[model samples]
Target: MLGQALLMALRALRLNLLRSLLTMLGIVIGVASVVTVLAIGSGAQSQVTRQIRAIGANVLMINPGAARQGGLRLKAGTRATLTEGDVDAILEQVPQVRAAAGSIAGSAQAVRENRNWNTTVNGTTTNHFVVRDWTLSSGRTFNATEEAMAGKVAVLGSVVARELFGTDDPVGAEIRVMNVPFEVVGVLSPKGPDQDDVAFVPLSTAKLRFLGSAGGTARDAVAYILAKAVSDEAMARAKASIEDLLRQRHRIQDDQEDDFKVQDPSAAAEAQRGATRTVAILLTSIAGVSLLVGGISIMNIMIVSVTERTREIGIRRALGARGRDIRLQFLCESLVLCLAGGLVGVVLGATISLTVARSAGWTTVIDPSAVAVAVGFSAITGLFFGLYPAHRAARLDPVEALKAE
Candidate 1:
């Protein structure tokens, strides 16, 4: 009996193929939108997670805060208040600190032969690698001996290496930074954007050759300090200790603001994750509205279908067809329409997401659960909206329906 009802429903849909297709178009669009948005959102969240992991959750950044001069406030990190002493003090005074490194940065053009690319040059100690959790992809990182001697050695990030040396190995290659030649000692592993388009040099070399020494002040003055805690749970304590040590070192009074700011990258990462989740939920809600609209359209069409087939219903009833059978037939028709539309929408949405990821160089992850939920929701929509129409058709009086023209 069920199979027969489904077959009849298919035949009825076939008789009005164009209208059936048009009626399901809304469902198709809505499901596709939901799937595509979810893929993009999941991808974004994964990317953020990767970045956070790469940087390490136990890291803390201490930056020189804004300084006021003549009623004008300078940008943060412009005051040059942070120094190497602060980095040493943090490691020595803070029991939670595992490692600390001071660093300064400047923009320079790297030239090897005729190939040259502009990139950021970071001046840092060997401990910087420990704090950043960066690893060498090729060769080796410079040792403390080289750092102390201000050796003219450099490490290339993946992007800078690709730009300068192509497929050739950059290890032991000579590159000029601002006309000062240095041998590339190593290449860093890829760490996504912002972190990859850079070059690392010994702190002393950068201070002397590129950044220029301000009466030996440049060697001591660093833009920021990166400190890594012994464990993730110790980050807050380490931050507090570093703040107290710096405040004492800088001789700040109780009423005055400190000259530095402590930052936790983990907090920033959490905020970013929250924002991405909020946006995904909002977009999904908007897409769900489209599904509701599609359901309403299905309800309206089903009602019209029942009215047009009144005589058919009456004839079936006269032939001993139960009201439940008539109702089931209409319900099956609605379910079939929605299921077909949902399947097509899934395929379309997956295609669109893959295309966007390829063309835009973005990450996209299609969750099986999302697809299942979308299809299931569509089925529920069909049943809910088709209920009233199906019930109305089942209750039609055979005598009156048969008399209608």
Candidate 2:
């Protein structure tokens, strides 16, 4: 009986094929929109996390500012401070400090063989490699001897190397910086932008030969220090010690904020992850509304379908079909409509998700869990909205229903 009823329901839809398809249009649009938005949002959030992790999630940055309510806002009369002394103290006093280095950076024109390119010039000690989690890709980083002697040896980033030297090897090559000749000791690995577009030199060399000494008033000058903790267990203590020493040196009151800030990149990453998750959840929730709208469309169309089939219901009853049989037939019709739409919508949504992932370079994770949820909610919609019309169709008296038409 159930098989016959399903066959009949499908036959009804097949008779008006175009109308059925047109009715399902709302469901198609709703599912497609929901899937696309959620997939894109998820991809963006994943990329953000990837970018943040690339910067050494284990590293910590020592910056010159107090942490405010909204985080790192510079206001009028903000204490402008942080010094070489603070960096030295962190290295010498904090036992948890594994490697610590300070840096001052600026940009200048680098000239070689009359070919010039604008590049960032960073000045730092030999320990900078450890503090910044950098390793020599080729040749070598500057040694303590070079730093102490203020040697004019420079390391070229890959882009800088390619720009100036082409196929010729850059090691032992001489590059003029602001007309000051410096020998290239090594070429760094191609790290892309953010890290691989700069030129590096010993702190003392750049300060003496290129830039004049920082007189505490140079806003562009950095007394920035980076330190790696000895172990993950000691990160908290290391941060606290660095902050305390800087605050005491600056002579602030117990309650007054320090003139310096210490940032743990790991903590920043965790916070960013939390924020990304919240945003993804919100976006998914907003998209869920479209599914609800699709369900409403199914309900509206099913009610109209029942109204148009009143004579058919009366005829079935006159032919000796039970009321329960009529109810089951109507209920099965609703299920068949919704389930068919669900199958097509799922295929359509999945196709869009995969296309966006492949063409747009987005990460679309089509979890099996999501598929299950879509199918489950679709059946629930049929059950909830199909009940009333099925009941009304079953309760109609055959003679009365026939005479009314």
Per-candidate TM-scores read 0.90, 0.72
Worst 10 residues of 2 by lDDT: 213-222
Candidate with best TM-score: 1
Per-prediction CA RMSD (Å): 2.6, 5.6
Model 2 lDDT per residue over 1-405, tens place? 999988987888888788777666655665555555556656666666655544543466877763345666655223447566666788889999888877777789988896889999888877777765566667787878888788999988887887888888889989999889999998877644657788989887877787654434653344577888888889899988888877787798998866777888767767776786787677656656766676676667767877788888888899999998988887777777667766777788789989888887677766566666666666676667778878888998898777655
User: Cα lDDT for residue 39, model 1?
Assistant: 93
The sequence of per-residue lDDT tens digits that candidate 1 reaches over residues 97-174 is 999998888899999998999999999988888888898899888787888888999999999999999999999999
Local accuracy by lDDT, each model: 0.90, 0.75
